[model samples]
Target chain A: MAVEIVMPKLGWTAEEATITEWTKKDGELVQRGEVYLLVEGDKSVNEIESFETAILRLLPDGPKVGETVKIGTLLGYFVQPGERAPFEAAQMMATQAQSAPSVTADAPSLSTVDPDPYAGRDKRGPKISPRALRVANELGVDWQKLTGSGTSGRIVEADVQAAAAAAVAAKVAVVQAPPAQPVAAQVIAPAPAPPIARATPAAGNATRKTIAQRMSQSAHTTAPVTLTTEVDASEVFKLREAIKGDAKRSGVSSVPSYNDIFAKLVALALQEHPALNASWTDEGVLQHAHTNIGMAVQTERGLLVPVLRNPAAKSLTVIATEAAQLVERARNGNISGDEMRSGTFTITNLGMYDVDGFTPIINLPECAILGLGRMVAKVVVIDEATEKTAIRKMMTLSLTFDHRVVDGAPAAQFLQRIKQFVEQPYLWLTR
Target chain B: MKELTYTVAAREALDEEMARDPRIFVMGEGIGKRGGNFNTTLGLYEKYGPTRLCDTPISERGFVGLAVGAAMSGSIPVIDFMMVDFILDAMGEIINQMAKMQYMSSGRLRMPMVLRGCIGIGGAAATHHSGSYYSIFSNIPGLRVIVPTTPADVKGMFRTALRGNDPVIMLEHKNLLSNKGPVPDGDYTTPFGQARIARAGKHVTAVGVALTVQKCLQAADQLAKQGIEVEVIDPRSTSPLDIATILQSVKKTGRLMIVDDAFEPCGFGAEVSAQVGTHGFDDLDAPIRRLSGAFAPTPYSPPLENEIVPSVERIAAALGELVKE
Candidate 1:
């Protein structure tokens, strides 16, 4: 018997997916667990593996590369060598006749005359109730290919409701994956001109679309307030230089970057002001128990934030090594969906681009985000009594918080603690 | 509030109405002096003399015809037929004269008569004694057919029946006569065309009448242990069937099952299933199912008789299957 292969449900909320590529050609003998195709759902590419060890028989009329299809749509069949696939002989006959072929030979037997007494009524198409059809239309579910669990194999309202719930779960999965773009690029990017009459905008890829949707959602849903503060980074920079010197002497390959040091310091500051590490919900504010900080990395595809779990509880060396790997995976498009979920706070640094004091959008659900500017040398007063000046390293920190979650004073106090940690590294690092 | 048996509660309603009205009287065999075969008129014979609690011979047809004439003459007659099966002899008087007197008289004369009977197949009551023919009376145009299950509903509905001018048929299930439930202390009347949600649930809606209502409640309890909640609805009256309440429950649960101890063909369940199918079609998540008594005569054997009607276990199992769909 030939085994039918269909588009699998990627996530609970994923109704359809676009086929990106097919690794296995027609008649290719593929083993179980071998990647045969790649499909994109909710801006993420997922590799689909063959479930049976059989010769692949790609259907001539099946969905092609770049074609989007609903979940459970039959793509092709896997048949044994020398075994005729389903619909093969019919297609050949239809081609010869150049007309619609009669279904006498392959038509399903009437349930009353069928030898299998326990089988349900063999209908030509899905048997759905009026209520189920209404609900399916309302939820935008393709119910034609679904098997009914109702009596006498009839689709009912409950089945449609379950499908709608699964689709919602898939949408939630996309929301929790990644968020936001590079601050410098966002500031410099020009708005597109209004289209002329009858002119259409160019359709972008799934990643770009997802980024646009999330960025717009964050902007519209949040009551944003950006607070910028100049931090004297002389001590924090010296602390990193000393660690780098020790690592070089000890032959340690991994050295903590400023972002990693800031991630640690921010986690400690968030611990003191726990409200900053919380999410706003209609029910109440959820104060996260662990400090999972998301580091925004700009990749070729789009912006991806890989969350580092409980950074406050980890050592600086571990955070540096893990952050390096996470950034590498995210840029290479190898980061799994799980790695980008459940972030309590986010940090997007534009220090490498020589940007200074740029506001960043808040990554929602999270209460606040920290944007770091480049550290540069500036003349500052060393002693107010003597009126003497000295060169010190200064970096601008922009904290964008959702005002609905925390007040201006509390958010400013949290930023003050972060500045205190940067000016005096011993305050938090010693603990 | 005070709790009373179904029989006692109904008797109290009749006794209270008889005391309030001098024109009201009861007629049945062995009821005047013997105080009714089911203790229906227990002490009413002494309070209201023999003229009021009048006894007649074993002639259902003769007295039923006389009650129709007496009702036309401004007297309210309460006829207590011991077994509902015996009323089959007086079907002509009930369906034609008693059900159409007020309508035929152009509202000039009133037919204020209450026909009470014991109906149900239990206690080994053979084919001759056991019968539930509420569906036949409900089909008549001018008759009000009430089949109350709980003691509270029986007492309350009985008051409404006596006060109304239309002829009413009150069929009390034999199995539910001794079942006890709380009744309101003072004078109260349960209006017709309203249903009671005996138990609230979300998974499946089970609409039952009379004995089936009690059985569905028991089945609901058993199904609750398995996390399968079943809502039970009792349409207290058969003629003025409260289909709105049943429809609302079906909308919430999305599934419906009608549990009836009467026969399946043209039975009360058939009526309810048709009404719900027409009015509440979109609310259904499954086929409207009817768990009714077998289409056979009442048997003499206890086990055979038990097999005809739906039991608690059968109702629970049917509800479990309906909920899965």
Candidate 2:
């Protein structure tokens, strides 16, 4: 028999956890209650234990320490050492087998039939087991007087015990009989499955709620001044690949996508252009001294901008790590609200979809929101004199700034700095 | 003294706090010789020694748990999770244990544990190591959550977290650690559960935290161009949320809009709306609205991720809906 190892809910909030360490080697024999692995959560670290003695079979080797292991993921297959276990076949059969027994037409009617058949239909009778009926024939407490508490409206031992106690309390003569009596069992019928209905309307309602809310606050209340520019993205893409490769070689699983580098560049650009790192406040232009950059993350659920704190101080490796984590949390619908708030400058990237550019709303109280699009190959004159058309990778940059806080010139300059950083990747790296 | 970034302000807070209190010490991964992942604890090792600025293995749960134990044993332990994203790696310790230990022990155990979490997304660390989760700690009963948007706030909040009796999760926005703000050299602590009226207005009220507050302030400035005046409130401490300050602002303005960078289905913005809807539902002239990150995981691609999160347009649009209502 194989016992399924499912993701344990370490905390009350969520079920998924990141596997940090695996204590046992694959195919090694393990005893019950032995520590198998260590899982990391939002709050604490927990050690998972084996409940059954078996051999371990871990798949997807070299699973990174911080990657999420979802609920119901098979951590490993349990099998006896030196013996082939047909756990897979059992699992398949279990899935195909009927969950509950079906009702047979030849069986007695469940709802309308009399609970007990020995007495007349008009006279209520106590339901008795085959053994209880024989015992009652000898002692004679009226079977009709005994009540039932069991399922299918049948009599149970507890009911008999209560009646006997009540008879004794009432000073009625007790009929002594053998203690062993057949107990009636309840027949449980399979529950009918509920009819399936479309979920489109509920989903549509949620979308409408979001749209209505966004339309009113984002469009009407704030004066959104969008600034657009095009930047060469060849270097940004190359740098990302290089970083990811280097990190992998070093045993540190770093997935620095192009967005991560853009975030870093924006953070640096905010340093150069402090005007863009501000939000318009009621107290008249509240200038933000620190540049907390927020990035837009697209998940199955909705759009979320998880801000990376103090990007200026961290290395590219650390930044890459943090960006992956935040985006993953956002996608999983597990990110907390605090992570979403407090972005001095926002970066929205739609590069992967191959879209050139689109206007993005400002993540208010921040002065500017940067929109990024797909990196495409474009013909450029390598040398003006030669007129040589060379294929160069390029992407569009759109900046939506709070006009009240940032003027068009500064906003353009912020985009210009972003462009320079992307083109000259080494400079951005140095910063 | 010198022009300092937000990270420097944090480092300064640590230095100053350590100099003032002999009982306070910092322990975390790469904090000693490496100066910390973000350099927020730079040079701290040399000044305080290994005992004070302790560095441990990549075991966040182990070290953070040790910090909680250390705190109850008479020492004030400041544990730094290299990144706020990584902090979730030890949520069990921070939330279930550190946050609830004192209360569970019926006040017999004094937990002076300060958790410094590096939060937010800017660098392209897709989905895992970026973004803020202050609400995660704030939602729990025993924890105090703080997100510092400015250099001054960083220093002030750090001071307050260190002195507080309960465990505090100090969320340090990663990108904000570098920009400079003036802070008093001596010592001063900003009280917890107080909202700073970053911007005052009469037409509408906007509430936010950390960088989102900055975004709301920006949205407010833009709204000013359209003859819309917005009052912006920043709750530095998320747990002991100052509902009074937020409600008062909403009552005076009659219009309320909440902008949060976190995902929107259920967030701090939702909490603000609930509080307003329940307390001053009649006083509100417009429907309370919240602008938050789209309900999704943060994407790695620039455009897709950008489209998914909350932006100025979204915040402004929500405010517009409220105004029209």
Candidate 3:
């Protein structure tokens, strides 16, 4: 028996994936556990291994490399040597020039009978209601190619509406419209310039398209409010320097970065303020028990957030090592989907690029995100009681939270706790 | 606004009309002293005297013919058939004489006659006492058929019927005689050919008549909980048949289901379905469905009678299925 090989599902949110490379070609012998192909999905590349050892028989009309296909699409077949593949047999039957056997003959030709009887019959087009047909025409949708979700497989008006909506969404993804102006605004606004002859723009890759969709969805769904506060990071800076010197003396390789420290502090603060570590859902607010902090890492392909599971429970050294590996894997575009999901909160740092304070879009389901800006030496009154002016290391923290989940006062309190952690590291680091 | 029962509201219309126009009189069995069987004429006999609220024997055809002559001879007579099924005996007088009086006389003679009756199958009324044959009168050329469901509608439509010069047939559901609702004070008349959107929705359009209008409203409420909204429309009159309102609703909803307590064949449901199918062809997303009484006659047993008519559950299920299409 020949085994059919199809595209595998990569992630929960992945609808399709592109086959970047195929190691085994046609007629190549493959063994179990051998990497057969590399598929890119959810902004990461994954190796698909062979489940059985057999001779590879690649389909002639299969998807080419870099061509994206839907999940479960048939790609090839693994068959034993000297066994005819399914498509090969069909092609041979077509080229044999065999006519239907004579009905009056003594023996009937069984080869003329189709193995799947239903495949040979004439298929009727989709049954569409008159209203749906009118709507499809008005919306310029192709009704014949659509599958109806109506009674007795009838295409209805709602199905047409959905197809129209999907078409508009695909157009938006392909156009990659300006981030400032929405699609609807662009449609209603007058044309800024006359049409000019230009080459066709390149369509965005699957990862970029997915990012655009998620960012747009988050911007639309969440009522985000960003609160900025300048914090004195002199204590956190000193704590990191002392930890680095101790690690160097102990011959420890991993030294905690500002993001790793912030992740730990945010996780601890979330433990105290459970509302900030909650998800806004239709049923109710989901207050996460374990603090799975997601550290946003900008990669060459796109932005990827690798989650650190229960970082609050891990030691500072263990968190530093794990965060370094997660960030490295994300930048290399080889992180698994499981390592990038189920985050309770997210922390994005742009301090290296000299970003001061900016409102960040909330990752969906997660309620709040903390953005870290660059730390600078600013002259300030170090002691208000003595009125002594001194140079202090200060950083601006921007906390963006969904108002629907937590009110202003609670979110501000959570941010205040984070500020306390940064200003006085001993308050949480000792525990 | 004042709350009144369906019977009291309709009686108030007759009282106001009879007091305003001396030529307006009511004639029915026991209507003079007994106030009719269903209190249709309640205490009006003493107020209007024997001449206006005259009592008559159990002769439907004879009195219907007498009222037809009175209507042609400059009198607005109201012939009250306690049960609408009794009007079958006077079909010839209604279809040939009453319906064709003004048309036959080339508009020279005005036929301002009000034929009022209690209709619908409920409370073991059986076939003889329970019949909603407004469709039959509606099929005729020159008759205004009104089947008002709410108390306010009954009062308002009855005022219109009493004031119009055309012959009008008012069919009041026996099950809704005591249904209380707010009615406007002072003069109010609901015009014929106008339909009321009993409940506004967006998923499915349901046009109901008589008792079925109430049933559809209940079904709409039930379906709303399930997120399947059903728009219930009550065509107050069958002759004019407010196809415009029904078409507009179908245009919005794209699915249509007609519920009538009458029989399926040649019933009010069939008539509305035909009109909507012809006028609102492109607006329909599903085949026009009719949830009506069974083809059999109204049974006497409670179970059998209940099984014949469309209940709220059946209407809701049908609407749910229609909206999916």
DockQ of all models, two decimals each? 0.30, 0.00, 0.51
Report the interface RMSD that candidate 2 achieves against the true structure, in angstroms.
30.1
How would you encode candidate 2's per-residue C-alpha lDDT over B1-325 as one tens digit per residue?
Answer: 4567889888888889899899998888888878998997888888889988888888888888888888889999988886778787788888778988898899999999788877765566677876778766677998888887878778888898888898888887765777787877678787788888999998789987777787787888888899888899988888889999988987677778887777776678888889888997745654677777777778888787667666777777777656544
Cα RMSD to the true fold for all candidates: 19.2, 35.7, 20.8
Clashing pairs in 3: none
True contacts kept of each: 0.50, 0.00, 0.86
A239-356 per-residue lDDT for model 2 (tens digits): 7777677777988777666777777878898899988887555435655646677888866666678999978778777888898889889888788877876667888888788877
The sequence of per-residue lDDT tens digits that candidate 1 reaches over residues A310-377 is 88888999999999999999988889988888888999999999998988998887889999999999
For candidate 3, the per-residue lDDT at B262 reads 86
Q: What are the models' TM-scores?
A: 0.57, 0.43, 0.54
Better of 1 and 2 by lDDT: 1
- For A251-300, candidate 3 gives per-residue lDDT tens digits of 99999999999999999999999999887654357566568999989987
- What fraction of the genuine interface contacts, i.e. the true contacts, does candidate 2 reproduce? 0.00
- What is the C-alpha lDDT profile of model 1 across B28-145, one tens digit per residue? 8988889888888899999999999999999999999999999999999999998888899999999889988788889999999999999988999889888898888888899999
Higher-ranked by DockQ: 1 or 2: 1
Top candidate when judged by DockQ against the true structure = 3
How large is the interface RMSD of each prediction?
1.9, 30.1, 1.1
